[model samples]
Target: MFSSALSVLALASLCAGVLAQTYTIFFDNKCGRGTPTLVDQNGAVLSTGGAYNFNGSIIGASAFLQTGSCGPSGENCCTLKINDDGAGPECTKSVGTNNCPAEKCSASGGNLVIIFCD
Candidate 1:
């Protein structure tokens, strides 16, 4: 009975791990000569470039962007929402003079690309 219980526990643990989902946020800063900031939904600066991966559970969580070498108080920041539907890999300038368009998320993918600038 002990052996069987251990097996069940192990299976449960494995299942939990398998059920957990992770999503990646790809940041493309093409603003020419400025460093971009990526902020999480809780107003935390998660990263400043390239990419960031987060737990898939934060479905509606958003990441805000600050372009240029504006440090933390920069202007022209944009917002990108976290989605796990694999629908996007899109771009949108939430708040900026930059002319980037909003892209839709993919339906079966976990990769989202946010483009700043061109």
Candidate 2:
């Protein structure tokens, strides 16, 4: 009986993990230079926050940052704060402009595509 109960408990844990979801912000450098920062609905930096890796010259660099959130779908749209890295403020759409579309920040697949538009 104890063994059976233990097995059930383990199964439940596994299922929970499988149901867990995460989100990734796809940053674009269409304009010039900028980085996307993830913030919660309350205007706070997400607990699990990090920057994306940039490649090529600074003029045309591009990358994406990722953040993890186990919250519900509708309650998980993060505020993508766009910061134009000295390339003219508001030249991007991910940070300065609060117009980046929100999508399910999925664990398996990436959500929302952000870009720096000049």
Candidate 3:
């Protein structure tokens, strides 16, 4: 019985590891315009939604999933890196100005919503 319980515990640990995946997002503030790109550790696009807009332009400015402003219709599930190229507004409003310091992780139906924010 002890051996059987140990085997079950081992299997549970293995399954738990397989269930969790870590993704990262980087915030670029060098450019006034904060461009968020999502990629996997292997750098892949999980969402058809484009680039997300981090609010520098307007308050109601939404965090789109892709290149333009999109609603929930926008949240492309990709790891993001911020390129701080001097442009539009000012990306630095907080510490996550260059990296996804604020990581948002959500688990749903074996899928995860990992959000990176500057």
Candidate 4:
């Protein structure tokens, strides 16, 4: 009985780990004097370097390349944006009064690389 219970526990642990999703954000800054930053909606800094790693999915998060008036978590910037919603991750572009339709992500899960000035 004890051996059976231990086997069950071990199986549960393995299943839990398998169910958990992992995500990595890589910032490729191909420009001058720019720092990459990722942030959430509640004004929390995720990463401020070349790469960031976390478990599970992210929603309403923002990424910014340190430059004029770009706030932490990527607020107040005129550029392309990506966010993961219920459907999936999306790529959006906002310019003036004309905003383009968001592009959906087909990626299952893995590393996300954001390149700046490239």
Candidate 1 is scored at a TM of 0.64
What lDDT score belongs to each candidate, Candidate 1 first?
A: 0.54, 0.37, 0.36, 0.61
TM-score of each: 0.64, 0.42, 0.27, 0.70
* Candidate 4 off by > 4 Å: 85-90, 97-109
Q: Which pairs clash inside model 4? A: none
* Candidates 2 and 3, the one with greater lDDT: 2
Tens-digit lDDT track of model 2 for 1-118: 9999999999999988776543334544443333344443344443222443222112222222333331221124234333333332121323442333442221122233454342
For residue 27, give model 2's deviation from the true position in Å: 1.2
Q: How do these models rank on lDDT, best leading?
A: 4, 1, 2, 3
Candidate 3: tens digits of C-alpha lDDT, residues 1-118:
9999999999999988775443322233332333444433243442332433332222112222343442232243222223322122212222322233354444343222434442
Q: What is the lDDT of candidate 3?
A: 0.36
* Runs of candidate 2 exceeding 4 Å displacement: 47-110
Q: Mark the regions of model 1 whose C-alpha exceeds 4 Å error after superposition.
A: 59-65, 68-76, 83-108
Q: Compute the lDDT for candidate 1.
A: 0.54
Scored against the true structure, residue 29 in model 3 reaches a CA lDDT of 33
Highest-scoring model, lDDT: 4
Higher TM-score: candidate 1 or 3? 1
Candidates 3 and 4, the one with greater TM-score: 4
| Candidate structures ordered by TM-score, highest first | 4, 1, 2, 3
